[model samples]
Target: MNSTLLLKKLYKRNLQPVLTDLKFAIALLLIIALFSITGTVIEQGETLDFYEANYPLHPALFGFLSYKVILAIGLNHVYSTWWFLSILVLFGTSLIACTFSRQLPMLKVARRWSHYTRAKSFEKLPLSTALEGRSLDQLAPVLAQKGYRLFQTDDKLYARKGLVGRIGPIIVHASMILILLGAIGGALTGFVAQEMIPSGQTFAITNITEAGIWARPWLPKDWLVRVNRFWIDYTPGGTIDQFYSDLSVLDKDGNEVDRKTIHVNEPLRYKGVTLYQANWDVAAIRFQVNQSPIIQLPMTKLQDVNNKAKAWGTWLPTKPDLSAGVTLITPDLQGTFLIYGTDGQLMDTIRVGGSSEINGVTVKLKDVIGSTGLQIKADPGVPIVYAGFGLLMLGVVMSYVSYSQIWALQVGDRLYVGGKTNRAQVGFEAELLEIIDRMAGSTPSLSAV
Candidate 1:
């Protein structure tokens, strides 16, 4: 019994106060906000080489942040770091403690109906009046008509409404707790991957760019994604307007399960994984040399060009000994290719299915195949987070309702009336005055003081 008493005392005096302190909760919130900002400012899940090039040590970023610091502190992935998750858990516990120790008790007190039995009790209320020659019988119906719930004894009465307002803070706290749980859940189980798949090619989730510690189970292993076709829409000025990829989901038996044409901001969701059309590239060039078999050569992006326009190019040998060749260059998948001779001079221009005799050979451009860049992600907690936000908005709206209460005491010839509201004080005052006026009409001798 002595040990139990000591434990209770320690909980009440030590652990409970710190967790219930508003300042501590606010401090935790500020710390979380600061770390969230840091996460946004710093790119997450980049390669070591990328960080080395961008945040070099010779002139470190901000004179302190370098690749070494980012790796050591896990700033490369802030949300999954142990310290950040610990802070989230601590903040959630603080909210739970505050709800139990402060908000719930306040709600309980508000729910319990009590009457101001003495005239002195009326003196402390924000809105109070004493009426002479008025009984409780004359005032009860007036308050009831004004939408005030009433409780009465022979000499004391209490009436209240908008009890739901008292529950709003509790719902708000609950929603915040749900949001924290969702964040933690996502941090531990979500995964992100990227793939650049050429048209007519099928691929699986093999290149994971970023993932949580326990994200392997969430990764898709039973299905494959096939890119049926990739095409782009160009504006009148030759700029890309939009790109699209027709995709199909295949089962292990190579049967199509689902199909969709996805574009930027329009993602395909299957099971829990979402595939977004993030980028595109020129994959390969298909052509024929002098009625030979159709040959497909891989294309690569060119660098160090004078013009900054993006272009992909490949070389095609026209002679058997590789003594003569031409470079095929195209800025986009517009089926137009610029042919350059061995001396780097523009020889001719060709389109898809068009041929040109160059360097003693007939070169035919069959097609230009494009690749679709897809960003895949699986996050199990997104629905929970959305639900939490919805509840938070509802709670905020509910909290605006006014919870007003009124009390009156009848002592033979006098009635003491007092009331208070958690919100909308002016409206509550007007409502109370209207009730008084109605009671005065029934008792002509009644006068408010």
Candidate 2:
């Protein structure tokens, strides 16, 4: 009864809750995975009408899954979600717990050799060996011949081989921790900003995630940037082949600090800020005013109709009258001609989209202003994120490429060898038997299971 109780205690203490921890970890990882996958599928940072019109089959559903929902629930943007961050924290905690609770003691045992008596229970283990009608003589020399360091205790034998097998979980956990550390480092210090600037125009990256922080104490004082020029290339089939921009950075004094040419794939890096060519548009049109320029009398109060007509500008196709006069109002891309014969009198109106003839003066629509769009980023933790990705890949590689073991013991005259592996033990066992047969200078048909 005492032995039974002792065995029960040993089992309870030695056994690890590895499977339960793994299940929890896997579920957390899957949630993060789902968010990542969904981020790719959904068109992020777009207007609600876009989703509603596009997903007309489920308009109400799309409306519910609008930007507000995404922003509130952290779905439109996944990486910065509080719940996602918490999951990562929990994953790291669980990994640390599993590592310490189970792997540390196993490593201690594997690093030290213990004596095992020739009892009936010893042969019951899957990779167990028993001596048949043989005396334990010269056991040390026999074990030494099979590359096992052996120690003896009265009637017991202790042997160990490939002790490094115990460190497999440690290495795996260490790499996972490294990856998690890298991710945390990145999340705490990453930011991205975007702006549109016309040629020969300057702009500052003021806002991120629609949140502007003008009073950031640690931000650079002179975060001014400029675009000297922007260019676009097209393919023969009218497709956008490539795009680039010439950008300049300035300090507080507005001195020519630095300059770089950034392109679609190529980005300019300075002071942790990277400038990329995001997109381009038309802005700031330069066109001629198609009317005679002159000044009109200023009448603050319209006491009389004649005085009110004199207050109008003399630039357009209008004659001075008590009621109306022509006023030429021209915008960049769209122009209009107004013919007012008196004050507050609608004589005639003409827009560029349509045609109008007033006093034989015709106007034509010209050009519009063009703009170059750029996306700038200053992520102090991008390198760390990349490092994390590399470490994660390394963990997978190590987990997949498992290093196994073979243990050979000499019982009397017969050489008994056993094999074990944390994973793929059957394949390794067959290979071990084949190696043993070859060492004995005989061909044994070892079938791989």
Top candidate when judged by TM-score against the true structure:
1
Question: In candidate 1, which residue pairs get closer than 3 Å at backbone N, Cα or C atoms, i.e. clash?
Answer: none
- The C-alpha lDDT values of all candidates are 0.90, 0.56
- What is residue 202's positional error in candidate 2, in angstroms? 2.7
RMSD values, in order shown: 2.7, 10.8
The digit string of per-residue lDDT tens for model 2 on 1-449 reads 99999986775565335422678779877887887798788665544665555444444454566545555675655665567777778777777877787778777866665544334434433454433433334345544575655665545555555455566567677767666666655555555666777778877777554211221432345757878877666677645687768888887777778898888879888777777887775443222224544232211212244333211122332343423235443221123435454354656765544545554444332432335677666555566657756666655555564344333344455434343556667765664554444353454443222
TM-scores, in order shown?
0.92, 0.64
Instruction: Highest lDDT: give the candidate number.
Output: 1
For model 1, what is the C-alpha lDDT against the true structure?
A: 0.90
Provide the lDDT at 346 for model 2.
57
True lDDT of residue 246, candidate 2: 83
